[model samples]
Target: MLNVALFDKTAKEWREENKDLKGNMRDYASLNELLVLANMESFNAILIEKGLEQKERMIELRKLARNQMLSLEKLNKGNLKQLEDKKK
Candidate 1:
């Protein structure tokens, strides 16, 4: 479900699509993706404790994934630009 929210696919779906590949989709996830997955796991636990419905949790998780990914990407680009500027 978390995978569905973040990657828009389930572990089973990923495995079926990547039969030739080894390990699960997570094994092939980017650093940013893995970070978001961890955060989502924790957030999911909180949502579960709060008695939120699966649909509601999924909506919230997807929002978190999108926002966090964008923020991380921007931060990474900004840091890379800073490094390149320092080298110049």
Candidate 2:
């Protein structure tokens, strides 16, 4: 089960902290960028909770996090392309 609250809080915090870097929320690129940062922070917190002894798990988590970010980027690009096509 995914924790919606945790991700929402992380996303809000990221928005608050990076107000200067923020782009319009309606834009797919901007929205995806925010989500990626939020996910990274959430994953970092989970990694910290796992502690140092879980070396193998930590490595796996890092890879998972990277893949998740890349996936989000690809999805955002695809979504934007679709939107552009619709606008044509």
Best lDDT goes to which candidate?
A: 1
Give the per-residue lDDT digits (tens) of candidate 2, residues 1-88.
Answer: 1112223334455567568875533232455445655665677577667674455544554566467767877888999999999999
Deviating ranges (above 4 Å) for candidate 2: 1-52
| Residue-wise C-alpha lDDT for candidate 1, range 1-88, written one tens digit per residue | 9999999999999999999999999999999999999999999999999999999999999999999999999999999999999999
| TM-score for each model | 0.97, 0.43
lDDT scores of the candidates, listed in order = 0.98, 0.56
Residue pairs that clash (backbone atoms under 3 angstroms), model 1: none
Highest TM-score among the candidates is held by which one?
1
